[model samples]
Target: MAARTHGPATTSTWAPPSGKPPLASRIMRATWRGLPAKRYDVGWEPGLRVPAADGGPLMTDHYFPRAEGDFPTLLVRSPYGRGLPWSPMYGVLFAEQGFHVVLQSCRGTGGSGGGFDLWRNEAADGRATVSWLREQPWFDGSLGTVGPSYLGYVQWALAADPPPELKAMVVQVGLHDPHALFHAHGALNLETALAVGTGMTYQHRGMAAFVKATLRLQRRLGEATTAQPLRGAHVAALGGEVPWLDEVMTHPDAEDVYWNGASLGEVAERHRVPTSLITGWHDALADQTFEQYDRLRRAGCETSVLVGPWTHTSALQQGWPEVFAESLAWLRAHLYGDPSGLRPTRVRVHVGGADVGGADEWRDMEDWPPAAVVGPWFATARKDLTRQAPADRAPLASFRYDPGDPTPSLGGPLLSRTAGSRDNRTLEARDDVLTFTGPPLTEPLDVLGPVSARLSVSTDTGHADVFTRLCDVDPQGRSVNVCDGLGRLRTDGQEASDVTVPMSQTAHRFAVGHRVRWQISGGAHPRFARNPGNGESPVDATAFAPVRITLHAGSALMLAAPADGAGPDTAANG
Candidate 1:
């Protein structure tokens, strides 16, 4: 889509055809029927023009309580357009809850003037919107921000130079670093990048356009991921050249000049706005949310976090009730001067049970990580995971990863439909993937906090990627993923390399009769762009090589056991 510049236009109200709700009232009623009782009738005025920093239009929709005297306002700026999910879900619903909701389309989207330049213009554009709010008659100066994904990013952008009226923020499944989203551990997150590109390209157009674009991407995914040069391979799947995708893919280094000022994480350290962060354990941006929480806590900012079991999208759908309640509580406590709705704890996480006799309930705590006991379970030559150290320092396992036939990615943290925990029995059966299974637990074991794998590995190519995962094998012999991470290995001199692969964080309980399994592989293809097995960049490589990886016996999986000593301290086979 070509960029368009528009002269300022008079604010106009747009009504739904047939003079009814934008969507049929019954559909809206059914969708949110279980939510809190409506407090007011929603009044909407669409197509309000808020001038950007450069005088271009930032098209907005105003959802207000029809009988409101004065109320706090919530600002939600998004590039995905103010339709479908956003219209009724955020604009109308939040408005009915007694807050004036201004849902605006980011510049260059949804009839907004000026070309969208990704993250470059958000800070200035957001500040301009707040300035516009100050002139409105209903502006009572009590303000908060809430939304998910890019919407969360915009909140951070605004927090960088927070206006005086800004009181609170709720960032759900948010990310502060775009670089980390596209490139993690020095490899492209190919699938997520493509999915994001597709959404940005067509989602603003409408649901049909977005759905069609997604289908096209799905059809061409295999071909695009396998193309030799890798540079222009995504054009076919993405429908056209996505300049930002190309720029990010080509520049893998986070410190590269191309990514300067792209990360807004510093805002968390500098600002003291009471922020509530929500993310799912399987959400693609879970790590970012953790980072946000840590920074905000360290800066002495009043902050709270809620981690659930849903993925990036599901957090807004299936997890909406919980997410909405958490968000509304935070906004009410800060914006409405009512702490009655707030929870007593600053941290809350949903412990995943998954058909096992585990703690499948919401846990509240004073802080994150909660002082868990750290323990290491070692890998053995017999393909066993035990707290008992290996008797001898010997080679534990070996696998050859061929980039031409790279190991495929299964369910885990991802943006697409194939995200969240999946049975890993098939993935573990792959020749390139090695699994070290612990004996069936005699009792239920709960793992909370961060997980990591410390490996003493040697690769024939001296350059490869290591993918480490922690899984829960049920009594039925089903291996399901919990959390996983990928680390890049590039060494020329060491006989063996000791590297730490962060498996992000998780709150899960392993049931009685379940087993703990540590799975290791050279690469999770297309999940983390295939490693070329040489020093060459995966994107620019036209040649591929295979790497034989050897795992030393002393390598171990480190986990954070609950602080209460409520679980097993050692892995013992039943």
Candidate 2:
């Protein structure tokens, strides 16, 4: 099919098209939809095949005002079908608010031609689509991109060499570190690699086929992720071609050219795009979002961040009203040159804990970590995390880790369906996981910044893994996860000590009477692929091996606390 040739302006007519709600009705339905000065009825334009730099034409569907005047464009390009995130309601909502909304399906998905080889194809296609949009009569030669996850990645790909028409972008949970996305240090997220990747196997196929394939893959995902010699098991679960999955499994090292070519680290620094980032404290990409904001700002790019208190999908679902309002304000100020729409702030974090309906209070700060001092809590031989430093080396605290029965994931930052804080009391009961609980706080202890754990340990096995977690122990003794980190190591027949595991960032207030707890474990099950302790890649290893992890007096966990109030016994930095 040929692309739509939008000609010069003609007298436009407004009407509520058949089987669709009116613009006014939709706006009223929204709890927090931005109301623009100009309002127009939306008109749907579908089956528009935009020609790409690649021979294949990308399929697009536009939802725009019926008014005859050209308007600023908001483009969302993703491998996921356009209806997602945007849905029909959001598509019309944007269009009705006096913007031209373009939903483009990335190559090989949503009937667009070409294989979806991940982020590699986005740069050229994104630039070409911008060129095509510039030619359209409805576009005012200004464009703003908005979406979450992969949709956000497409924006970064375009920002590498931004087209003249490109104005700004609203990135939500964007992936900046390709290495961390797949391999967390030397470990792979088995569920993501096997299940999520498998579900995307039929992206090129029609919706029906894709839906059926995804459903089938998910039903057997747990077993598939645990399969031995996992190099090709994901493909088998997909029951169709997933060549990329094979390639990823075979190459577990981040040093691979494939990861370098796709990672957004270098490309982000190369260009400046007025970007607004909306991320969640519990989202898998939370740390990456903050990292990108800092990097972009340092590179002289105009960037603002809003960190919420929700999971990966919940960030989009429950946070739509909030994030969209901020994003729309950002777009209005940036793309439309209306400064009143946006308030400048380097970082706006959701101070977590003691929440109503899981929503935290927001606080704007000059930087990511809000002027906090590093306070350390040392591990004692008596199995307690303390503020006092050990005067002498104490006896070693011991725990045996068996990969066959790795501790189950109680959820913190994994991208599975169940991705958020879960009660950890049950998980802490396991003999393999060592628990170090602090005394009940008589007053509130507000921790806000990057959290990490340093372990001084000696493992009997040549290769071992360490997983450390921070939790809030309530009055009832229920331990809820706050944040956690995992470290994979290869001792090569020697004992390793002072291992550092960088946990995900968080901004939580431990309420009065709530005791802080740390669960030091070897593995967190399939959330992070279990280390076999044999120097073998997790991609192909399922066999469990027992390793004795001996923790000595020097092991410690630390958090960011206010510098103003501290004691002499508190150690500085981890």
Please, what is the TM-score per model? Answer: 0.94, 0.90
lDDT (0 to 1) per candidate = 0.86, 0.75
Q: Model 1 off-target regions past 4 Å?
A: 1-21, 24-26, 354-359, 565-574
Model 2 error, position 537 (Å) = 1.5
Tens-digit per-residue lDDT, 1-574, candidate 1: 1211222211222122222237643276556745888798877777899999999999998887765256789999999988888887788778778888999999999999989888999999999999999887677777999999999999999999999999999999998999999988988898898889998888998888999999999899899888888899999898888898898888889989999999998899987899999999999999999999999999999999999889999998888988998999888788877788887789888877633433257777788887788899999888999898777657777899999999999988899989998999998889999999999888778888999999988888899999999999888999989999999987553367788889999988888788999999988877778999878989989998899988987899999988774432222111
User: Could you tell me which residue pairs clash in candidate 2?
Assistant: none
**Per-prediction RMSD in angstroms?**
6.3, 5.7
Task: In model 1, state the lDDT of residue 194.
Answer: 87
Candidate 2 CA-lDDT value: 0.75
List ranges where model 2 is wrong by over 4 Å: 1-38, 202-215, 356-360, 393-395, 492-496, 565-574
Give the Cα-based TM-score of candidate 2 against the true structure. 0.90
lDDT of candidate 1? 0.86
